[model samples]
Target: MADKSTEGFYEVFEVFSKRNEKTDMQYQFSLLAPNHEMALAMAQENFMRREPVIDIWVIKRSDIRKMTEEEKETLKRIDNKDYRLTKGYGYLKKKWREYEQGVLDENEILSWGEDKDATDRKRTTS
Candidate 1:
């Protein structure tokens, strides 16, 4: 009998998926597979069993250039930029209501350059 070594038979594949069309593709996990097809099959098998994902992507790990230890350390330092998401500014809604004004939400913000009449119609339809 002859012995065969499988040294570079399989490689790491990073998996990414999203729940629906509107959601962003997030890093799900990683897996080892011999090729892209097998990697995708493994990702689909794992993620599909856990959740209903609208999309799945599997890419060679070597293709991605992740942050180095120093880069990560820099990211962990103090004085990081302050970010206030819409949820963090919920109080503004009440404040604006008190002034008889509506809060400019995502849809309103996106419709800024469009026709006010069209925007109003879209809002009403929604």
Candidate 2:
């Protein structure tokens, strides 16, 4: 076999996929291919041979822009933006209780997206 390192035949490619149209894309696995097309083709056979994949992506590892240690440190700078989080509005729960009304927390707000009957049943059961 030819020397892959010198010829660049062993280029690393990261794979990502989604199970269905509504699902979020997730990391699959990495593969070595000479080019993007081959990497995409190989990904289906190697990773999705026996599974259902709604979408697939093959990105050359070298093409991804990654932050260096120094750049990453800049992201650690903190800002006083507590008002953007639910904790900042925690006093609303007590205020609502004073009015004899319930306050919807994060979980309650998120559960609104589920079936109404199911959510009601879950609330009753718990």
TM values, all candidates: 0.49, 0.63
Which lDDT tens digits does candidate 1 get at residues 1-126?
A: 322565578889999999998999999788989899999999988986889999998999999998899889987748634354556666877887777664566777767756777888999999
Error of 2 at 114 (Å): 54
lDDT of candidates 1 onward, in order: 0.83, 0.85
TM-score of 2: 0.63
**Residue pairs with clashing backbones, model 2:** none
Displacement of residue 14 (Cα, Å) in model 2 is: 0.9
| Candidate 2 per-residue C-alpha lDDT over 83-116 given as tens digits, one digit per residue, 9 for 90 to 100 | 9988999998788787755555777777776668
Error of 1 at 105 (Å): 38
Candidate 1 global CA lDDT score: 0.83
**Candidate 2 overall Cα lDDT vs. reference?**
0.85
Top model number, TM-score: 2
